[model samples]
Target chain A: MALPHAIMTALLEDDMSGYELAKAFDVSVGLFWRSSHQQIYQELHKLADRGWLQCATVAQAGKPDKILYTLTEEGRDAMAEWVLGESRVQEGKDDLYVKLYNLSEDNANHLTAEISRRREHMMQRLYLYEKIRRRHYANPVSLPVRRKGVFLALLAGIRQGEQFLAWCDEALAMLGTIDEPVE
Target chain B: MALPHAIMTALLEDDMSGYELAKAFDVSVGLFWRSSHQQIYQELHKLADRGWLQCATVAQAGKPDKILYTLTEEGRDAMAEWVLGESRVQEGKDDLYVKLYNLSEDNANHLTAEISRRREHMMQRLYLYEKIRRRHYANPVSLPVRRKGVFLALLAGIRQGEQFLAWCDEALAMLGTIDEPVE
Candidate 1:
């Protein structure tokens, strides 16, 4: 259900081959959602089989036929239904947080290490967002509303990254004096 | 691994029955981490079998024997190793962002609904944080460092929740006008 929704939504803009869809997802959808190339190809076939997507095969020089997918009217209805249907937030199931909880209860020293690792990880994400923003600026999409929303989302990600990094620093600093007698 | 870490960390504070561990997770650890009771029990058994945790059975009236779990030195060692290990940020993992991305691309109307759902969810989380904060103020823990850190985390959660809810309102307003072009 998730895969088809993504596929249909992508097709609404324009028809794209499986490879092309995967690449776009990497650049655009990849920011918010991710599906492997293998998974995308598999879903393409499924959508085509279900009549929600129509495929046009174009032969490339010395290469396999590339099937491009487009959304049908039925697919449009499906997307509309999905949007209006009973929506629910999938609870965040974070393993790292769970581990942190354990560390917090047991060992302060262990938590310090985890905080260090998590801070570094957040820094990496901040970097990735910068790259994505630069790419978006270079090749502007006509949908400015969508682009603006994405930029805001990117800001949120950066904010969150910084928060985690800052939290790590604070946690580490506190650790130094954690066992020492309070001043 | 995450589950085991959570269980061990809980034990680090003091040996706790599975039920108490779950409640502690919900009240305190839950500010940043989350886990289900079933998962906690399952991980406890696994950790004990692996010699990473020591368990003591406590008699209870009108209830099954409650097993109290405590982390072993080896478990602490493992937790230390994990905490100090390199942090890897798993990218493209957020479902809500992905959904928003697709919504922006497909239709503004759909994005509105998603934002609405997020606003409500954040408000609910805000309430939960408030309840926890009040309880923490009433009863205290041994480690002042941990107590302060937990409060800081709760504050962060509250701020983030407020920001998200506010963002949703702004987004909805923008969507409302964007869809209706100037006459």
Candidate 2:
């Protein structure tokens, strides 16, 4: 329900500054739970206030001092407990589905174009996830306990992406054969 | 972002009272796009005020007259234009992914139990979708333009549900083999 719990999992690996954390989320953690720079910084402060995350200032010779965020023991405890808690399964909102739901002979061609564009986009994302898998999780089955979680999480996205591409293919093919409406 | 467009698509099939519209959403339209009853009712009023939907009163001898909603030409125009408009592809938020991301030796078993429960739940949903497929979309290949859209929309949810079950299986299998944390 909250971003702190997700952020704690992101911080489990190593200490990171707010900027670094934002970047990390943009690449990995953000894939599941999205957060903005302002949001991550705000939550970081709130977590530190709750004694869940400890913040330390690292001096930089040529720039402003960097505040690094480290997950506290309390943070890890909170994350571990949250991990085992009952969570809701979400039905995600996709506008493409809305278009498809309203598909008619009139808009079939237009909708298929949009779907084709989406297919390309999904493929790019799959490529990115595959690159991540190869570079980071080359051997998922043999990964240690700590590392396995990240691999599986990324795998979830990869599987969804693959499934999405298939759906797009199914849609495009079906829409391609629609006859013009009899006016 | 607005539910009105999606609700308009639902009303395109037949004129229905707010109650009927809500029920229709629960069964079919709510797969990719979800809406609460209150939200649906509110959006219906907004669409009527916008002159996109017409509300007609039908009297019942035994009960209060029901106001049924029908999509106007303007509503069709709106939905048509909106369908052709560019929209974002979303990465949905799923808590299971977060839990899997945090998976470690300590919580592996507990997490897998939750995942197993989710797997069963997903199977139930798949069964329901399959029933819908059999009852309605028996011949997807030959469906008319008006009907094909609904079939494809339902197909998207089925595909995603199938992909989710696969992800759950992957997570459970991996977590099942995790080694205890070295103290």
**Per-model C-alpha RMSD:** 5.2, 2.5
DockQ of each: 0.31, 0.69
| Each prediction's whole-model lDDT (CA) | 0.66, 0.84
| Candidate 2 structure quality by residue, lDDT tens digits, A6-123 | 7887788878999989988867778888878999999999999999999889999998999998988888888888887788877668877777788777888788888898899889
Q: So what's the TM-score on candidate 1?
A: 0.73
lDDT of 1 by residue, B1-183 (tens): 355665666677787988989988766654454667898888888888899988888999998888888778998888767654544454535555545544443456666777777787778888988887777744434445556555555655666676667667766765665553334
TM-score of chain A, model 1? 0.71
Compute fnat per model.
0.28, 0.74
Q: If you assessed candidate 2 against the hidden native complex, which CAPRI class would it receive? A: medium
- lDDT tens readout by residue for model 1, A1-183: 356676666667878999889888765656555679999899888888888888898989998889878888988787666755555554444444544433343456666666677777768777887787777744433447656656556656766666666666765676555563344
User: How accurate locally is residue B29 in candidate 2, as Cα lDDT from 0 to 100?
Assistant: 72
Candidate 1 chain B least-lDDT 10 residues: B137-146
